[model samples]
Target chain A: CTSPCAAPFERRRPGFLTLGCRGVSTGARGDPHSEGKARRAGRIAVCGKACLAKEVFGETLNESRDPDRPPERYTSRYYLRFAFLEQAWDRLAEAGFHMVACHSGCAAALLGEPSDDRTWNSYIEYVFFRS
Target chain B: CTSPCAAPFERRRPGFLTLGCRGVSTGARGDPHSEGKARRAGRIAVCGKACLAKEVFGETLNESRDPDRPPERYTSRYYLRFAFLEQAWDRLAEAGFHMVACHSGCAAALLGEPSDDRTWNSYIEYVFFRS
Candidate 1:
């Protein structure tokens, strides 16, 4: 439809902006007409703590009709885009995560998967560096 | 004083948000107490083309007093953060650019320069792939 049917994202905080479909599936990934569960949690785990990164628009990940196996098998990725905090770059980098930005000002690099046909949300990878 | 004097940003387009001072200068880079040109244009060049990527709040880049040198020497970088366009991921990759994103979702990876101390703008590299 209209790329997740509407605004297709969440505005968590002042500078926090998540663009495109709610989860990875809603855009072209999860065609609304499909009859069953499309994908599972594109979750986030940092410092051994896991959190729900995807915004459930109409259906939550658990509300779907499939038994959960693992989030890794859920190939269709999701994105959570926001400005970084102090010490965030080094912290994320030290944990095997990568970042990019301009030279002098704040903000460097976008984060996520390598490359795919999907072209709405930003990229993300659930890499538990410390664990 | 309050990090670039105030709200420290410009809302160009409804989803297109530039979060931080007018240029890289107004922030911690160029404290208001300092009375001179701090940095030159941290501009943009894409597809062998360049455009006005910065917004001038009060003093335009040219309005400064210093004789201009190459923009590269003007470290204290600036940022422009927005969602990418269709075919952008592959196109960016083909241009020696790298991206990351979620697996099954539409959004994948961010783009820009490697890790640095700056924290407002998204990372960028003037890597001209074709040329």
Candidate 2:
């Protein structure tokens, strides 16, 4: 609708999303071929709490520039890298996805415990497929 | 509640499940401290079409016994292995998941095209967290 959400090749189904608040934008952003089609062809994004972010991109990245201990690098701040992102890309590739983009942002932890006073940095992914 | 569905830490809210057909058992399986407390304490599962499967585990596995040409190895059969799954585990780690399991099964392509004759082999992942 208003850049609230998007996915790779959502246009293939057209009506897969019906929510007025959240659905594929059928105008400019809706058209995956509008621009950057060559690189950003078909991208899918999945965003949730920090926990889900960790589940999708929270790993002691092999290519991480930071070198610390604690399995996943227990640093002072929350950070994630492309440690196993290739797996996600590989998985989406089967569905014809040629590219993916990962993003992390802060949001109210609606699913966290009541005693905790912190926001969750939701990890999101953009999956893309080509024509 | 039947074993048709399950998740990690769903019991934290007790009444989070309201469905009569697909919800937590709330009895034996509901307790995370069961006999497998030492090993199978926390687990989560995510299953969907083969396309989703390839997104999660599809990669030229570093541990794959089969070595081929394609970037992901254009094998003769539908297969996937752990490559970037660690990223998923890391993402969920923030949520307290300690382990993850991946599974693939065949199911009717409820979302595929009408002309396609093949069933979709859904890829599933079981995520676990320890108390």
Q: How well is candidate 2 docked (DockQ)?
A: 0.01
lDDT of 1: 0.24
Give the best candidate by TM-score. Answer: 1
Candidate 1 true-interface contact recovery? 0.07
**Please, what are the lDDT tens digits per residue for candidate 2 over residues B63-103?**
23323333322221223232344454554454443442222
Per-prediction tally of clashes: 53, 23
Best by DockQ: 1
Residues A19-96, candidate 1, lDDT per residue (tens digit)? 121112223334556443323223321211112122221222232322342321221223223322323334444433
TM-score of each: 0.20, 0.19
Q: Per-residue lDDT for B1-131 in model 1, tens only? A: 33221222432111121212212211122121222111212432222111111222122223122234232223223322222221222233332333322122111123233332122222332321221
Runs of candidate 2 with Cα error greater than 4 angstroms are A1-96, A110-123, A129-131, B1-41, B50-131
